[model samples]
Target chain A: MKLISVNDLSLQIEGYFAFKHVAFSLSQNEIIGINGDNGSGKTQLLEAIVSNKTPDSGTIDYTPGVRIGYLPQENPQVIEQSTGKYLEEMRRLSKKLAVRKDQLQAMITYMGLSPYLDTPVNQLSLGLKRQVDFLSAVAGHPNVLVLDEPFAFQSEKTIQRMLDLIIDLKNNNSGIILSATQFDKRIATNFDQLYLLDGDLKNIAAEQKNEPVSLLVFHVSPNSMAITPDVEDFLVSNQDNQIELEVPLKKRQIILNKMVQLNYQFEGMRKIEN
Target chain B: MKIRILLKSYLQLYFQNFLYLTMLFSIIAFELLANHLLEIGNLKKFSLLLIAMFILSLFSTMNLYYNDSRQNKYLKQKINSHWADWSSQLLVAVITNLFSSILIFIFSLLLRDNVLVDFVGILGLFSVGFLGSGIATLFQTQWYDHSTVGQIGVLLFIYLAFSGSVVNILTAVEWLLPPLSKIIMTLQVTSSITKLLPIVGQTLLYAMILFFISGLVYKKNRKNA
Candidate 1:
């Protein structure tokens, strides 16, 4: 079932000519990556999805009871306050889905933030603060997570951990949408689909076998190829003639000797035919 | 369930402000210092200062409430919860009033005179502060953060008109103003009022009325927030 559908949505910032038309459907258990250059309407689109801002003209139909968690680009400050006190009050007021204090604690721990649990949020580094914000948003186990640059300012290890959590949530039937400038290979490999928002919003799907494959031809220098740890595996993978390796631009003799000692084939570089 | 979560979030945000505790301690210290400076025989001056401190406490809480409503994300959610919003406001008012009254009583005790009068004065101060805060919150909910100057003008007008010999005017022209005169009268003659009904009973009645008004305001604001 489609959790959220945005059709012909257009947003215009008042007094400015900036405007964009957006349309998309988010389905259950899907990981959709939104990529775009700076100044594009990526953040605005996310804001519209989160209901933080209403579109100038469009339809955003969200299923009621479909919990939407948004991790904004900027984190708000949570200073030295007793978490239990606030949580207890919320529990008393019955404003939360779950009053299980352990779940909150667990989320804090899962982010590798147990030691700083009692510390003020402002005292934490930018990366750790993002983790806290992410954890807080997902505390109720939201059905759809919208993360804007979730991996920004994060270490590789932390990013991997967050990816694992996202996969876990996806497995549990939660849909994930992320917007970022650069895509990690791990996320690119795991994501179910990709949507690129260029000068104009565009959605790109993975190439299917029956569909015409647009050649994304590029040359790999022999110097770069010589550094390949497993040349045999690289050649075997290139048997489809989709990849072309070029001769090294500089340091060719040294790299050639290394490739020869490793019993690797060093064909003169040529561009791949589409 | 949502109320609990929101309340928890608000409390965290509230405590995080750092200014809250600082203001609380400042009120207590100011009361102590004022008590020390007053002449031992002049209970009226001490009583006036106590009233000022009580007023300060109310204003501080009002400022906090305004800041929270304006800034706290979860408070926006709680504003939608009729029971939680009203109940929390009432609870905060009662606790703040009680704290201010206790501070006044402690200061009076240290001065070592007119204990009964001071106690009665403290009760009156508490009633005024509680009712004033409840009214302010109601007004705030109805009007979006009206100017501080306007609020102060109204409050000063009320004090000038009702706190003195104008009580007779207020009583005679009762229909002109709401039952605010009756509440002011009760506060003005708290000693006799408390004599008629026990202090606890009087406080309970005051609290009940405040809650009732707060409930109406809460419903109105919940629809608006």
Candidate 2:
């Protein structure tokens, strides 16, 4: 069943169109990813879907009595209360939104935030704050989840746990909408559908029908240039000493061998389809 | 049910701020210093306390409004109504200010024995608090983007409410402001119900209108939040 449908959405920020002529639908047990750079209206589009923002022109229809859980990109200005207190208050006020107590408790333990329950949310590290916000949103066993940049400050282990939790929620028939600049292979591959938000919603799969490519990330010493993979590799990112390349499947093993021969440190590699 | 939870949460946060503690202590300290050190009569002391209460309540209410605006986007989504979110915080501000006003009233009574005047002081303080919260809501929600303009407007309103009578040129426009001056005057001059009712009623009516207008403004503007 369609959980929510947005038709011809147009949102303007400061008299400029954030995103216009956007259309999409989310269904039960489906996960949709919105990829966009900064200021591409990803946050604004998500906010409109979650009812935190109003679009200049469009209609967003949700299933009757459908409950929504949203994780905003930023924290509220003043978080004077302890994390535990805030979460408890949110739980107490769930009201029409049902709380998944056991699930939430388990998530807290899994995220390793048990010791910081008494700590003020404002005092928490960026990563921990994001975790707390995520848990608060997940407290309700909502029918739909609207997450904006959920993995921005998360550690790899915590990101994996969150992905596992997302999968679990999907198995329980929850529809999810996630917005991010880019998704790691583990996350992107799991997306049932993907849309690129660049002034409009464009289906990524429909735009590119090519097979998945292998992504190799490694750190090379400045002197090791015996066999560069530039001949058959598309560089995805090069930050710090590490480089991420989208190489053809046929050249994946050759590049790995060349890196091994050149004494380059292998960080990680995976197949990605975008 | 949700509003109650939100109110309780907001109150807990409201009392925990160092500013609130300072404000509370200052109220007591001012009452003490004014009653003990100053060789003024009960009427003058009572007047000073009322003015202090009005200023403190205005700033205190503004402080709460600031805190509420920070989380308003998140809370508005939770409650699914701008009216509920705005009102819950307003109630918190009013309740907190009322507590302090009552405390100051009791402290003054202990220092001096003017029961009738002190009782009228409580009503004046309540009106001050309601009007302050109304103005704070108006600024925080509707005029948030134009904060400088809003701040100037608030300063002008305060100036008019307190010294508008002295500035006789603005006499014709007194009706447009909260009936704070009238309430202060009526509180001091007479102790008769017949005399107090009309002024107090005017103050309450003005406050109610301000609150109603601010609420509508908030509901209208918060859509773009």
Candidate 2 C-alpha lDDT tens digits along A84-154? 87776666556545565665667788889889989998899988898888887777777898999999988
How does each model score on lDDT?
0.59, 0.75
Worst 10 residues of 2 chain A by lDDT: A224-233
Quote the B-chain TM-score, candidate 2: 0.84
| DockQ of every candidate | 0.15, 0.46
lDDT of 1 by residue, A138-188 (tens): 665678889999999888888887888888888878889999875654466
Worst 10 residues of 1 chain B by lDDT: B191-200
Which residues of candidate 2, in runs, are more than 4 Å off?
A211-274, B12-28, B35-39, B107-117, B142-156, B163-176, B187-198, B220-225
Instruction: Give one clash count per candidate, in the order shown.
Output: 18, 0
Best by DockQ: 2
Name the candidate that leads on TM-score.
2
Tell me candidate 2's fraction of native contacts, as a decimal between 0 and 1. 0.57
lDDT of 2 by residue, B102-191 (tens): 887777754335565545567666667777766665666323566786788788778777875556787788788666676666546764
